[model samples]
Target: MKPTFIKKGIGFAIASVIAGGSYAETTESPVSKNQQPNVVLIFVDDIGYADMGFQNLRDDIVTPNMDKVAKDGVVFSAGYVTGSVCGPSRAGLVTGRYQQRFGYHDNIGPRVRDKNVEQGLDLSVKTFGNYFQDAGYTTGYIGKSHDGDDKKFWPHNRGFDEFYGFNNGAADYFISGRNVENSEESAHSSIHRNDEVIENFDGYLTDIFGDESVDFIDRHKDSPFFLYVPFNASHGPMQAKHSDLQKFAHISDPLRRKSVAMTYNMDVNVGKIVNKLEQHELMENTMIIFMSDNGGKPDNNGSINSPLRSTKGTTWEGGIRVPFAISYRGHVPANQVIDDPVVSLDILPTTLAIAGIEEKEEWELEGVNLMPRMTGKVDKLESRYLYWLTAARSAIRDENWKLVVPNIHVQNPRYELYKISEDISESNDLSSQYPEQVERLKTEFERWNEYNEDSRWGWNKDRYPYTNGWRGRE
Candidate 1:
């Protein structure tokens, strides 16, 4: 059954309860003298590299809020997520480690009867929320929580104080339903405020999340808070409000029009949160990081990841590279563009550094602290190798060179290499010319893979097999 849209008054305090197990209240620990800055991590789902105006890809696509974030802070041209898919990328962001290290190699499937094969993040690993909550910061999670489903894997259990979102991967924008009875029609119908289900919601899902985020910031203005807003905009089941759709009627392609509307709506909501921060005078000390969970799935939705090769679900630039920015009013430089490679895993360590929390060896974070580079304390970041692996393919970017090895399971596996710096679109293959470099990168990937555990769930090859005409473009 399609859930009804209840047009209740906006800004109603979202009801909540303790989830998972009980924990000490926020009042239990007083604010530290260090004065940790509030952290807002805004994650947009499946947005393309060229989708926003900040990237200067298309003048038609309006993303004022996102563009403002890039203009006010440092923009990373080579920013990447650990995985090309949603679940694994989110896992890496929350844990600051390669999802592969914890056996999350692919997107988790719908809930199943097998206890051992439950599709969620591993329980033993600690998340960023755990670190922040322990250090006297109130952690609140809004929007999508694709990490897990079991009580133990719930956001509350993983250290979030408040959670207002669904546990599934995707949800419909206009109507709400039950569970993942069907991926498209009924996915994410069941919304939750903490552990309780929210049967009927008033506005669009994007607007509801934005309003809730503003309310959270307003409520927690006294103390430092960590707000994780993972907007499920521009993902699948591409539905947009009639008003938003009207704004982009110029887009002739139906799918493309819907994608633009969805992206635009998310931007407007982001503006709401930013406005609230300014209204509460939290902009100065707050650190805002905006990024996509993964590259756009142009095949699924008509998102344009132009000037990059292929689209989501492949180990190409379009699949991994995403629009990334960090905004801290006085701390980070304004309108600076960084070409150095950085990964989603870096969010944890960087946030900890900003919060004045010392990094401990036990945390085992794989990402680097980007403060020095962003603040001009260091002129250049030391070269580092970034990696991405899925069931069908694997890639490693060392310095400017990138090597992609398609799965041997696929017939006629291809090992292609590109000098990514010179060929941003990955047009030319240098594997035949630089066999030694390919071998070196392959060896490095193997060494890194040695520490990774076997995948908890294998890839679903049959799931999204259609190509959206934008593959292999130079």
Candidate 2:
């Protein structure tokens, strides 16, 4: 089975428009080889596409800093993460390879004391920090380090020169405590500076990350640095500062009001970092990439991915697709919206390319260097396939066509096909009318699945039943 000629033509037309024209014309390049810009990746946890003010899906939420980032950079309208969940999505971003390839297909559960399990990112793969460190950049990580807690899996060992933040999936904002039961009690969730845990931290976690990020920038302003700020603001254990909550008193729903407060707090902190960059005169040379790890879990966090279907742990647009933008004051064009499909994996390769590093054969990066297309050096990206797999479902997207297959236990255990180009909301399923397309996508997914290793750790069936696949509307 193959995509119809007309559908192929339509896909190419869409791609052409997204690239800003046919291959005949070009625009001025925005990159400079001599000046190696500092890289700052601001990765937020569980932020929905509509939550940010720049997305224009929600009028109530105010995120001025995030809005400014979009205004100053190129926004990818069809941006996505490799996974619909946190751990795998981050794994793909850091390594520039599908997490499935390394057996990280599911979220790493709470740490188990007895069983010997490799819960974090695979030790074999080199992270972005590793590459940056090798490239002579001072790499520092601040905020939630959900990758792993094992001594070997720690961020410092993973090539980051300095590390601060919890090593678990979620933490209490006001105070830190381990969520696991019958485990050796320690400051497991407390903020850590390098290896020492800082107990009873004075302020909100988000503010703490912002202050530390500014300090990191100030300390390394004289030299190039790679700072990864993965804030855990709006994740779970929904807690917000009293002042922030008071500001959002008009919000009728308590959960939503709290979430908005947390978002406001995050935005304020982002502004602080931006101000620090300007003060230190690093704003122009620093390439800032801001994105969420995955879509929000509305049920758990009161996030709304408006106009998109499903949420968080699903293959729908609301899950994988997210708010993504890149800003480098003098290099990247400002206030441009690129509708091309770009994934989180591209972050690693794009950053490396901007840093004047050639792709090494040993790196095996699945993501492409987006600089050419981004700078209008290339009209369109070469066509590629994007695949996602979890224990309960699998999905494959090629060009504009997307096919999702849910586990038999799911409420609607059937194949879903959508022309995502025409229907971003995924309200229509054309599988019944386009069996050939479904077969083609399914075959592509099967071939890709063969390249992936079986998950090292399986999802707990008792905790999350198969029937409860994704708690978002399709």
Candidate 3:
């Protein structure tokens, strides 16, 4: 399963065009050894690949703050997440290990009170909270959580010193109390401030989350802190404030207009966080990372992942591939783009490396440190193949070569292969033309898949809850 030089990624294509006819870890970093930078990771939910202005995939969508982040940071053109959906993807990112390594391959619905449903992130695994807290840094988690609904799985108990957010997948942006059982339930759906149900301020949920993150930064600016803000913007149950909606009135499509307005609110909050960082003179000393939990789901939210094939849930480029960027002032070069394959798993290791911490093997982390690759100290990662597997769908990607096993529930399932670099949209099916490549990739994928586990409790899994659980698509 190891990827060697024999399997070339986008690196070779760039190398072929470079002056030396080769590529190496040659870019020098401008970071000093004496300082410890504040790490802020902003994780957005169900953001479209082409939605951000930085991606430039569409004309109607506008995201200035995210675009600015891309302009001032390094964008990974081939950035990927572990899962095409939520729970598993976040599990992999938080632990720095493949989610399958811990048997969390499906979505965990909103059921914190259901004793029969064993939901939430496995407490056995350490998260960004544990990593930074152990290193004497104040840690805060603010945003929507697909991790779990139970108290034990809550942020404060899982390494973060301060926690503020909701327990389920989606929450109403403007209101919470309603006759619907899913709304305003303190245990499962309502907003909470450090373990207690609290009313959201007179602003939208996205704005509230952003303000909370800004407050966290302001309170911790004097000390080294780690802030994880996973905003549930532009997700399902789309609702936008009148203020934002008025701005996007020109958008004729009602669904798209609402989606764009919601996203615009998210962008404004992101800008707020950035302005706070600059206000406290922590811009250069703070390491800011921005990315989505997974690709957009057009059917659920009016997200447009153009030139990306399909929407979320499937293992297409649109499902797993996402916009990933990092800004570290002197440490990371701005406006640089890394076309070589990289994944959400690399985030933890990269954070540890830049923070002067040694990633212990006892952790059994699967992701490689991305700082070296970004700094040109290393040209490529040792991991040759990035994999995503579940009961219904799975995929294996090596550089530009990708072989996808569509949902087994399909009427007639077949393997699909694509040279992703040349076919970004994944429109062409090369399986028939390259049977040998398909067979080879399938064989390798099977071998690699042997070590992973099946989905936890959704769709094909044995356990199931009343709502928010995975209901297979018709």
Per-residue lDDT value at 218 in model 1: 77
lDDT of 2 by residue, 1-474 (tens): 332321111010011111111111222323344557899999998988888777766766878776776778778878899988888888898889999898887776542212454567889999999999999999999998766556578888999999988777787786633322212353446677877766454677888898999899878877788999999978988999998899789999998988888987887888878777776667778888989999998889988886778899898888888988888887777777777788998999999988887889888899888888877888778889888887677888877889987663578669999887767777788999989999998888888888887665555645333321111211
The numbered model that scores best in lDDT is 1
Give lDDT tens digits, candidate 3, residues 1-474: 222112122211110111211112232233344558789998998988877767765777667776766667778878899998888888898889899876787777433223344666778899978998999889999987776656798889999899888867777777544413443343555677777767434667888888898899778877788899999898978999897789789999888998898888887888888877766777778888888888998878899876687878889988988888888887777777788888998899888887777889899988888888777778765658899886478888887689988875678778888887677777777888889989888889889778875445564323433334422222
- Model 3 TM: 0.86
lDDT of 2 at 307: 71
Candidate 1 versus the native: TM-score? 0.87
Candidate 1 vs candidate 2, lDDT winner: 1
| Model 3: residue 150 alpha-carbon error in angstroms | 1.6
- Model 3 off-target regions past 4 Å? 1-35, 109-117, 176-186, 379-383, 409-413, 460-474
Q: Give the TM-scores of the predictions, in the order they appear.
A: 0.87, 0.86, 0.86
True-structure RMSD, every candidate = 11.2, 8.5, 8.1
Summed over model 1, clashes come to 1
Give stretches of model 1 more than 4 Å off: 1-34, 110-115, 176-188, 410-412, 459-474
